[model samples]
Target: MKAETDFDKAEKLYNQKKYSEAKVLFESFLKENPNNYKSIEYLGDIAGHQKDWNEAIKEYKILKNQFPKTANYWYKYGGALGMKAKSVNKFKALGMIDEIESSFLMASKLDLKHIDSRWALVMLYIELPGIVGGSESKAIKYSNELMNLSKVDGYLSKGFIDEYFKRFTKAEMNYKAAHEIGNSKITFQKLYNLYLNKIKDKFKAQKLKEQFEK
Candidate 1:
């Protein structure tokens, strides 16, 4: 009961973005309930929020090992590793790419309906060089898969890829579809960004902002 109460307090703090206070409570609770996976997951999230990617990686590794069947665990583990790779030298980043890809692939394979892992794979393939398995077609394949899972995500992802490749017109069409379908902040932002940053269309950007804000 005490452990549960402590965990609840920590989780509340964590949700409120009070990482330091939550971390203290979680650590204290962990001392009593060392095997608490939820507590460990919170610690990992806190570490990630603090940009302590190594700590995040360590915690997520434990999570993946403990819950091999959990796609979320593998996703978190892969995400942490990918963040670490971004901070390191190119050679080292190259070395870690396969492991990161494998983890995300495992997560995707484990959960076919998982959107996040597919998005990660899309970005991974799009960003990587051809030598390392980057392929525009592969990215499109995942984007299509995302389209099946969630139309908004699918359109948003397709817009992202089009923007990445400088297909501004295609991106605009897709972003518009996403906003029309979802009408959420993310969709709005994507459309706004394309007009403002990518296409440099102040008229469209202003019109979009006005429409979205209303």
Candidate 2:
């Protein structure tokens, strides 16, 4: 009961964004209950919020090993690895790419409906060089998979890929499709950027900007 009360207090502190204070409590709780998954997960989240990617990776890796069936554990592990790779030297980043991809893949396999894992995989495939496992085809494949799961996300992902490749017209079409499906802030921002920067249409860009501002 004392441990539970302490954990609840730590969670409240975390939710209040008092990360340092929460970290101390969480660490104390974990010392008493080393196998408490929630405490480990929160510790990983706290490290992520602090941008201590290496520490986050360590915590998430432990979670993944201890709870191999939990999709979220693998997803968090992959995400931390991806962030750590981005923060490191180029040579080191190159070596970490495969591990990151594998972790994301494992997460996706563990839960077919895991949208975040699929989205991360799509971005990884799109961003990496061909020599290092980047494949536009794979990106498109994942985008299609997202389309099957969530229409809005699918269109947005496809639009992002198109814009990345400078296929402005196709990007506009996909972005418009996404906007029609759901006029979300992200959709509006993408359209605004497309009109303002890519198409150089100030009128359309201003309209979208105003809509988004509201």
Candidate 3:
């Protein structure tokens, strides 16, 4: 039997979100055909999306080496670094600020059309520490950018948004947003009720009750 085509295998793995496996296939294909920038870029994206930050960083690093004139590679690399720092090593988090911002800045400068890169930069800006990379204004700015990118009213995203903004009242307005969307497979109602009962304040309880009714 003939081996599966590189594209076919990669596509299947990608659809499954099997970044590590997909990346291996992509890398093998790239080794045979180094000019496939799109494949390389997608590999980096998949790695990042899968939260395999180191793999993402490695993929982007390869792209940056191949396409030194473009900033997208660097931007992706920095974003991966930022995620790695944030989710894994708090001590290394601040150190990545310069790398993250620089990549975003370069990507913006190189291609004003790369909304995703810019949006990534914005998110990093929002998540960074105040002494390091945190800025409330920047957070709001990037949050808006992310919302615009998402055409659908994403239930999980909206819930996090409400939680972040302290708009718990509004969260109840769409608590069903997640529940219905997930077909009740994801139970926020149970989690919310748990929190509601844990609170000691009467006014807070009343507020929760009113919000739950909505």
Indicate which candidate wins on TM-score: 1
Deviation in angstroms for 195 in model 1? 0.5
Regarding TM-score, does 1 or 2 come out ahead?
1
Model 2 whole-model lDDT (C-alpha atoms): 0.92
Question: TM-score for model 2?
Answer: 0.94
Q: In what order do the candidates fall by TM-score, top score first?
A: 1, 2, 3
Q: Estimate each model's TM-score.
A: 0.97, 0.94, 0.58
Q: Model 3: how far is 178 from its true place, Å? A: 15
Clashing pairs in 3: 128-134, 129-134
lDDT accuracy of residue 51 in candidate 2: 97
Worst 10 residues of 1 by lDDT: 1-10
For residue 62, model 1's alpha carbon misses the true position, in angstroms, by 0.5
Over 1-214, each residue of candidate 2 has an lDDT whose tens digit, in order, gives: 4456778999999999999899999999999998888998999999999999989999999999988998989999999999989899999999898889999999989998889998998899999999988999999988998999999999999999999999999999999999888898888888889999999999989987777677
Model 1: lDDT equals 0.95
**lDDT per residue as tens, model 1, 23-139:** 999999999999999999999999999999999999999999999999999999999999999999999999999999999999999999989999999999999999998999999
Per lDDT, the best of the predicted structures is 1
| TM-score for candidate 3 | 0.58
Off by over 4 Å in 2: 1-4, 211-214
